[model samples]
Target: MASCIFCKIVKGEIPSFKLFESDKTLAFLDVQPLSRGHALVIPKHHGEKLTDIPDEYLTELLPVAKKLAIATGAVEYNILQNNGKGAHQEIGHVHVHMIPKPRPEQGLGIRWPTQPTEMDKLKELHEELAAKMQE
Candidate 1:
């Protein structure tokens, strides 16, 4: 993770507008923000994806996100976590985007695209997932 920008930020090699820090994680303002109080929350340990983070670290990570949300006075907001290239993950480190909604200029104006799926296929897929969860 020597070249990872987030790791550099965590290590103080790169400057960030840091907001909050716990033993396990750090929260900071994004240089390029979606909204006024837009922030990124990241684990101190480098993890490229969600599952790579230890559960103990994750437990501390989320409450910090909530703290940022409240500290920013985000009356409505979204918490975005992305993984893998296909999921639009620009940075290889696992981080959460806390974007306050109703920004002065409509915020980031992000949208979730949807596609239709057959109900029978959905039911079968759900059943398959439920079976997998037990394993």
Candidate 2:
């Protein structure tokens, strides 16, 4: 993926405020940051979605993300991953959005409208997901 920006960053062809790097992954400050320590965690290998990466790689990526969140003094954080074009994934390469939510007044403010799901629906959805996990 020569055209991918994240690949370029990983290759050192593009400059990034790099925070951490491993053999398989790179963590860097987002150029267009939403907050003081906003960062993007990406795989060294180019992939368009989470499922594209092997399970072992994903296992390694999460702990690094947690370390980054703690190091950045994030009181709360959002781990956002967009899968496709319809989901607003502007970058062609897959990356995790590590948004540090230090305060409600700072960073990206999300207004989540809560709607109560029916108990029957919740039970059915849970069962469906649980079955998938067992497979």
- For all candidates in order, the CA lDDT equals 0.88, 0.85
Tell me the tens digit of each residue's lDDT in model 1 across 1-135: 899999999999999999998788899998888888889999988989999988877876778889989998889888888999998899999999888886557455666799999999999999999999999
Name the top lDDT candidate.
Answer: 1
Candidate 2 backbone collisions, by pair: none
Worst 10-residue lDDT window, candidate 2: 54-63
Top candidate, metric TM-score: 1
**lDDT score of residue 37 within candidate 2:** 84
Give per-residue lDDT, candidate 2, residue 109. Answer: 69
> Going through the candidates in order, what is the number of backbone clashes in each?
0, 0
